[model samples]
Target: MTDRTVTVAEAGESAVLDVLSGEPADVGDDPVGNGDDAAVLGPAAATVVTTDMLVEGTHFRLDVTNWSDLGRRAVAQNVSDVLAMGADCTRILVALAVPGHTTMADIADLSEGIHGEAARSGALVVGGDLTRADVVVVGITAIGTLPYGHAPVRLDGARPGDRIGLTGLPGCSAAGLALLLDGRGDGPLQQAHRVPTTPIGSGAAARRAGATSLTDVSDGLLRDLAALARASGVAADLDGGALPVHPDLRQAAADLGATDIDARVLDWMLDGGEDHGLLGTFPPGVDVPPEFTIIGRVRAGEPGLVTLDGVPRIPGGWDSARGAN
Candidate 1:
């Protein structure tokens, strides 16, 4: 007898789907979730929906990460977007395009990751689609709900007298990616890239704390801030000394033997995307939430202009079309 590995092609769609659908969501003691044609979520306030896609070799590399990590990444990024909206995550929908050669074990690993992260965010996997494709493609749609009487946060609400706030360090994930590319893929920085931890519930916290505008730092701080500035018709001036720099990032720069450690670290802090931290603005004299650090201020100037230490800084963020972050 010979042992053989089973692939998605050999298992067929029904079996693959069965493997992908873990435990169905329990709605009022009645199970309602994936495996059905569509998901049925309970009633809620204003619903907020966001969808994102991750493609193999473009958004991630299989050589550096496993299917489970990819699954977690897909869910985490979308949930971050939901948090940016000042809403609470309720459910998630995943769509996957997998090559035939992929193994069933890999799909199981992916499912585990998806469900695990969803659980962490107080959400459930309600529905999704699985299909055959040339390469692995993961699509995540996160559903959230604004609390009763609270409005969704928008980028256009910032005012000239607002203070800019950030929830967490901005460059950890980017530094992790750099370390991975350098063939030194260990330590906190690398872990940050593998599965970036988002500041859960921070969006709602900011909203309740009188945040006038909000966004997730999925892109670089300068880029996302500029967008908020343009949307609100204001200019943003960042205090470079105020931005938090992770110790791991500084050490990574040293390990890589960069001539300009400060410059390299600053680049990651300014342009490194995927940290999934919350960035927003609060009105003057409002007590910013404890979770947020005041890093900049909104001011009267040219719209969409962002300055660092009183100097105009060009914004650079993730551009999938260009295949760079």
Candidate 2:
């Protein structure tokens, strides 16, 4: 009997790191390059590191998206994660894999996009590598530092009576994605699909306002809220009437035969992902910032349960592997 062996690609930076390091290992401190946005020495104030990947078809579509937009979206999403951790992003390291058929101009445009978005977040592209591949794949790793001795607001801290706050409106990205897939031409929906404007500074703002728990809305509100519930050992009940939906999305949903606007909006709000807004929990007496709206409350219950209008959550939104099917 012959044993099957898996051979990883050696062309791209991530692939090289995977092959050499194996299993995405992280070494906190190193005298040399350390593979982080910046070198680390001993323990300083606070440091946070996050990495994310965007595949060509899974995370984006090249047909309607420009190279620059793709680049910006990739970087913005990763930086959003860092901010969700209550840290300010300082630098990023990017790794790109391009197919042989890809042109230098395409690669340059992608670089320009990455730099452009990074600059907006007050972060710099310190180092990166590029190589040939069968398709385009972008990986970004961001590093940030928190204030001295300030503990990051993790998901586990949400108490039974905590008030839930959200930074911005939801469903625009999901609605936009639906529009693009439905063969709708370029418009606001397409624009949402192209570039996601994340709430960059709101994470720190939430932290300063005494947020007990914090997370970014990446994997739909329900899925991510479920995570927060599990982490905090509680139940999340969202006010159906309070969920804000974009007007254009409602019109678009109606055109697409989605009769119940609430369901459609809930699908986008609870199930839709990639809004990049901060969802956080605050103490009962704490005053949430003006930018945040009270959407719900956290209560003591079995871990990993989320309720919409007082019932178990149903799936009708985005899943990366499922591709909105």
Candidate 3:
């Protein structure tokens, strides 16, 4: 036997599909699972569908992130989308495009990452497609279900006197990216950049806590909040001092030689994307969930306006066309 690296081209399309499929358990007990032409999900009061695509050189760099982390990040981001709408993720469909020279080991790692994340989110990898491309592209579509009694949360639900809250730290991922770009060092922040984690059940919790409006911080906090405010026809005022800054993130700023540490940390918190934290508005007089910290309040003002500490601030975040932050 020859010890040779098996490339995707050598394995052919059939074998590539098999590797991506993982195991029959990956599909759970769906009526039609992996290897089938299509998937059949159970009935629900309503269905939620969201799609996200990550391109090779754009969304990620192959040298920095392994296939496993890339796979996990792809699924986690999409799952956060469905959860933001106050729905339970039940199934997902993946579509991959990779160059022929890609190694089979990389494909297997990618598949394992996808399956692991799906299981953690209580979702099934029912079906997907694999094909050849000049660059690697991973596209995933997540499906969520809302039960009869629960209503799907909307971006337009915020009103005057509502309280703004956040579930997780915002700047960790951005700090991680900054370190990676500067070739600083490895730590939790860098890992955060590689494999960002979402607050898995926070969306449903916010809904039960009477969240008037909800969104995930896939983009920067200010940008996502501004969009939500625009949809709700209200203005958001964030308390600059109240915004929780991660201790590690602060240390990262100092390590990077930031003259003004607070400013740099604030920049990451407001402008960093991909932390996958949940942001929502709760009606005044309602006790917000403990998982969330009250950071701001909603008031009547110019629609889509976002301010930090009573002063109007510009919204800055990741814009796909504009490139990485």
What does each candidate score in C-alpha RMSD? 2.2, 7.8, 1.9
List model 2 lDDT by residue over 4-72, tens digit each.
122223233443333322222233443434355554444548988899889887788898788889989
Higher-ranked by lDDT: 1 or 2: 1
Per-residue lDDT tens digits for candidate 3, residues 22-60, read 777644445667786788776678999999998998888
Candidate 2 has which clashing residue pairs, if any?
none
- Cα error, candidate 3, residue 309 (Å): 0.7
lDDT of 2 at 149: 74
Judged by whole-model lDDT over C-alpha atoms, candidate 3 comes out at 0.88
Off by over 4 Å in 1: 1-4, 28-32
Cα lDDT tens digits for candidate 1, 113-189: 89899988988888788899999999999999997888999989999989999998989988999889889867888
lDDT leaderboard ranking: 3, 1, 2
Candidate 3, which segments miss by more than 4 Å at Cα? 1-4, 26-29
What's the true lDDT of residue 90 in model 3?
A: 85
TM-score of each: 0.96, 0.85, 0.96
